[model samples]
Target chain A: MSEIVDWVAVDWGTSNLRAWGIGPNGAVTFKKTSPKGMGKLAREEFPAALDELLDNVAPARSGPLDVLICGMAGARQGWLEAPYLEAPTDLRGLLDGAVRPTMPDPRIAPAILPGVCQKAGADNVMRGEETQLLGLAALTPGFSGVVCMPGTHSKWAQLSGTRIEQFSTAMTGEMFEVLRTHSVLRHSLTGDLDGPGRAEGFAAGAAAGLDHPEQLLGTLFQVRAGSLLSGRQPDWCAGYLSGLLVGTEIGSNRHLIGDQPVPLIGSPALSALYAQVLAMAGARGEPMDATAIVLAGLKAARSFAA
Target chain B: MSEIVDWVAVDWGTSNLRAWGIGPNGAVTFKKTSPKGMGKLAREEFPAALDELLDNVAPARSGPLDVLICGMAGARQGWLEAPYLEAPTDLRGLLDGAVRPTMPDPRIAPAILPGVCQKAGADNVMRGEETQLLGLAALTPGFSGVVCMPGTHSKWAQLSGTRIEQFSTAMTGEMFEVLRTHSVLRHSLTGDLDGPGRAEGFAAGAAAGLDHPEQLLGTLFQVRAGSLLSGRQPDWCAGYLSGLLVGTEIGSNRHLIGDQPVPLIGSPALSALYAQVLAMAGARGEPMDATAIVLAGLKAARSFAA
Candidate 1:
């Protein structure tokens, strides 16, 4: 097939790098991914890793091919430092602060977009999520309301139309992992949270977290206590823990959410869980596909640059 | 220099075994500690570990010497299971539930005291803290107040005279360890919290936790954000975490504390921190020496048996 590649869209995160080849018609002609993310690469290794991924993929060109990148690639320790653009920032203007790193391959022209930062109360920052937000904005133009992007470090962003007014980060997922693996709660928690008992436990935990977030320290020990006293299963314990953390996150940030339905941008499974918990808290969670939003975000940024 | 031993008092926990040689006149003639706690010993290994620690200390006798033990030695997986006594339990009656484990040496007749359990509310259990509570009760003959025992798993007990009304456990220390070693917050945390910045951070965290315990999920990330934005030192982050957890613990269980001073039974440094935080929460922390209370408790129990 004789294809004329117009541009490339790359999501260079901490642990993974994904790229999609865009044709002149703005359609994805080819897609590829690698584990050589910003976390594994030094500043000197970025160009080679990019070249390796795009070597046979990019069409023969007389000049450098334009590549638009987002995420940790623009972090201080990534391929090149693309300083954060402080909020309230317009999603369309993300490409304005894009930094161009020196490339070894003359046929590669990469522009890394800057992440978002909140300089006010409880200062916060996000790299890749900014693009995800941009993608969400692209999918729903002039999007307004709270956007929850759940992950290892879950981000809660307040959006006024297409501009991010402010944002907050919660260490819920990370906290859950640490407690489940390294704390005494590990004794009572095992296996994945897939059972019915886990689901019920999750709901109960979410309720407890919402009702008594201050009681987190006391409630956590209940995993072991319940196991010893009532012979509660490991799955239930895991579910309860998940519910508690998610519930606490939602409860703590409920003030940020208005009457508008909260849009959760993340993996389907995680977003579903968040949705379930949000429903329990008398709120709505609209699950949005992460990949779709990310691609849309990169495409929007590309068009804005052009 | 010849001495006659009356009985042995032991605090045999999960990680360490501490014993005191009681003289005929109720004085501590010898004190020793070992890492051969219940966690390190199998059912058969317990006799040998105890013998090693008790060697050349017991008086020459054909009959087994009476040895009173407390803590994890009475757990289900310990030498012999000394089942838990449900609350509301009388401190003086702890010996009634003591179980004697079979020993290899005829000269070692060890009796393990049962820990207390609360089957109500959130379902709680404690092995060593019961003994500590007994010690606290012995120190204050008619003690009627909330007792705070801080450690790996901190316990807060409501005591009326010699009876334990109810108790709650918080995995504060364990949570701290997990967050510091395994969580993403570890990146912004390190070293002992001793600097001025750390103290300020600790106070601020404690206040935040006490004032708005619901904000824990959001507040935890502030440690990292502050570190990234304002160059917050590692010690400050550690101190802030410690304060937040401790403060939340106190804030959550504030209903347990009346107008009376809260007796804090633990080590000096930990007790001091708790005391400071308690003062911030508008409660007084009366620091009580742990060893003194434990010895007093054992002595009282010994006399009761006689």
Candidate 2:
């Protein structure tokens, strides 16, 4: 049976699903996304959703569908639990398989690779950031420093020459949400601190966090009690909290990173926030459009197949 | 009629209300407390509840009542809104004056004294802790150094040569409640972390918080994902969160505290936890019973009249 696509590269995570149709030349012919995030959907329903995405970008071609996927889909509850590839392994060895589900002749997108950790006392694993890193490295030539990928779990990766150095993840974004939306501190934190987090609130939060890395939790409570008992504005308290988390992340990673220029591949707003924070921490950063990096990453992976 | 008792002293806060009866000799003839905490009563009903506490204890005295009070009863919503006494001001100056509610006979209970803060760029206010500090000073002669008071709003007060030099409040305990019981992190944290936070699981969490303060939120997500994917225990996650807040408190106070020994005042269990944390942070600490401090404070305030 003839299939319709050459290669498809997909990036799926907790909240969103994205895919790109690629020609042999590494050019994207179509790109599509859906709200069916891995966090919301069941494993059995993933194939139907993926097929709908492909059908929207369906074209008349006579070839087998070749697809590469990554992200939470490689997680345990994901479509197919892609095993982790240890640190230092780039894109090639990490590919799970060319998945083809029964619902459509168009292949079910293959699960991208995940990272493994066997170190004593550390059993953490990651699935999507590695693919993003590959895409990021492919986009920027001679890019060797820290690749700051900010999200629910912000990652700080050290790329030494061509080999990936050590990396660490900070739950800065998620913690910010918990503090602002769910925690008792929420009463004191009013409105978005600034511009999808690029505001002075974010920068201030980042700076404060770095300077007073130890008081993150203790200082947060002062927001509620201070505001209620003393009439402090809710917004300032919010900004103060943002400062704690962002500042801590910047401080923790500042020493481990290099003076060499780096690339940021994630939401533009979050990427900007990270850059602003890095500057405050004495680290200079140049913004790399996350979309460009994702596309470039697909190309880099395609080069291996060719 | 010869006045049998000159006045009364009451310490009222969120969860407890306590009062002391004094004779002309400054000797406490009677003492009583009730669960009439500010948290349990309505704003309009404060006077009645306070009256009930006094009524319960006043019967022991031979004559009229002269009462001096402190804690939340001095706040805006308190009895008569006794304004705060600035730093270096003794109990006499901080007193806003006595209030005589309609139901009472001896017609006089001195107002509570409030805490004052002058730290620039930070909201400064005090409530019940000031009274506790005053109480501590009266009880302990020539005592100086830091006082670590543990509760929902934990305080670290700097005592120098019979005066409170400076103080900072940490929201450690409150944050612990929110993270463990309220936020999304609640899913990852279940059951109590063994023995009122003495279990090894809690210790491990504290260590994680100390080692990676920024990874707090990210690690918390693992509480949900870990259980969903690989069956990680939820209670351990709760303990880990406890450690983060406690660790942050220890870290924030590191520089400001410079080798001053910590005198902790709380329950045996909480004192033990604080001591454990202080040890982890390399700070020296000794537990001091709160009951002793309260008694000493009452005696000291009485001596001022002598």
Candidate 3:
């Protein structure tokens, strides 16, 4: 029932995996997603997980069809460990160190793209986002600017032409999730997130985070205290905390970001939040379609066929 | 047997409760502890929990014996909500609005001291630490300076004579714990914390936190990356992270602390660590015995009894 496909492009992350079928004519058609990601599967279980997803929509070809994978699936503890490609190198070098995993089925060929790492200054690493960055580089020729990818571990990169000069990561998303779910602040952040006083609270928090980041740790308890002593609503508290964290991420890297617009490669909802914070700090955000960029990155890797 | 026992002082915190038996002569003779605290018991279960603890070391009395209490037991969610007393007031006023809970046992007389709140500039609140600050005042007459108490929710308070002018709370301990146990940093923070490279790692992290607080969120990823790419020891990561958080806490409040030697109150180990960080910041920390001060504060509260 599927159209003719030459290869499958997969973005396998810690929590989930998304796949796209690519035709030889550079057209992307078939699509599938599974919650089973690298985090869920062990070394031995990966083959079956991959096979299950591939068999669902893979076109029947006389020869073994190629499968290109990016993200945490290439992590050290994932399907197969792909060594990190050091930073300052153009992402085109990503395919040179890609790992080819031996599959049980003779009809499947898979290659895992290596993640990028920065050892000097501040040690940092990134996997799937590198592919997205590559896609950004591919989409806009000679693009030179700062890019922000918001996620569990929000990443910021400085790209000069095709080479990534340096990068840093903020524990913004992960910190927010953990603090909301596990900390005392959890008590004050319970209600419909989109309901009541949210905009005011987010604005107040974002301003504080962006202006006086030195007071970041000191002001966190105010989220709970405001709710308790001042009767600040739960929605307001949640929004405020989210804005505070996101704003802090942007503020901390404002020097690298400059006044120039930043390309935000992330989910629509999260990217919009970062865009809001950036605008507040005199900078702007240019929203790039995440799916389109990542697919482009995968297709770029496909061209280096053996 | 406790000699001439007259009343008992208890510090019932979130996770544990500690009791000190005081004689009519004002001598603290018996000390007992239990893991059951305000966090574990429901509203109805508080009485039984308190009864179980008091039933053990509480002295025999012909009439109802007074049980002086402070800390989370007086929290809105604790045994009984002792409403917070707004700041800029002497902590000796802690006893004025202390709640007297009607106990199940006729022989038990309980009074829970109210916590302090700063509602104007920054919404802030503290439960048991108010009593600790009261004790500090009682120990040093006319003591007017800053006090740093390290714990799950680290607190810093400014004292003018006996009055607590203002205070702030940091989620340092809680943040470190959650990140270590729940975040990706958990993978690299294993092995003995006292094993090796502890001091060097801590120093480096402390410097980073003290000199550049805005880089806090950006540099956290380095803890994990260091271990992965740079062969950082687990002890180093643990020590580094610990220093980073503690240093950030002190660095953020450096202006409030000024050139004055801050009083360090809490566990000896934790207080000593804070002292070390303070020393690095060109200030000094004076270690105050927590038990001695709490006993004095509770004894001070006991004087208000009818």
Give the candidate number with the greatest lDDT.
Answer: 3
Give the chain B TM-score achieved by candidate 3.
0.94
State the lDDT at A63 in candidate 3.
83
TM-score-better candidate, 1 vs 3: 1
- Each candidate's interface RMSD (Å, one decimal) is 1.3, 3.9, 1.0
Worst 10 residues of 3 chain B by lDDT: B53-62
Q: Candidates' TM-scores?
A: 0.94, 0.83, 0.94
DockQ of each: 0.74, 0.34, 0.73
- Displacement of residue A147 (Cα, Å) in model 3 is 0.5
Chain A only: list TM-scores of all candidates.
Answer: 0.94, 0.86, 0.95
lDDT tens digits by residue: candidate 2, B30-126: 7788998766777667767867766544333554455656677656655556555545444433443333333344454444555555344344456
> Highest DockQ, which number?
1
Error of 1 at B192 (Å): 7.2
Q: List the residue pairs that clash in candidate 3.
A: none
Candidate 1 lDDT tens digits, B225-275: 778777889878888888988888888888888888899888899999999
Model 1 CAPRI rating: medium
| C-alpha positional error of residue B128 in candidate 1 after TM-score superposition, expressed in Å | 0.7
Q: In model 1, what is the error at residue B70, expressed in angstroms?
A: 0.9
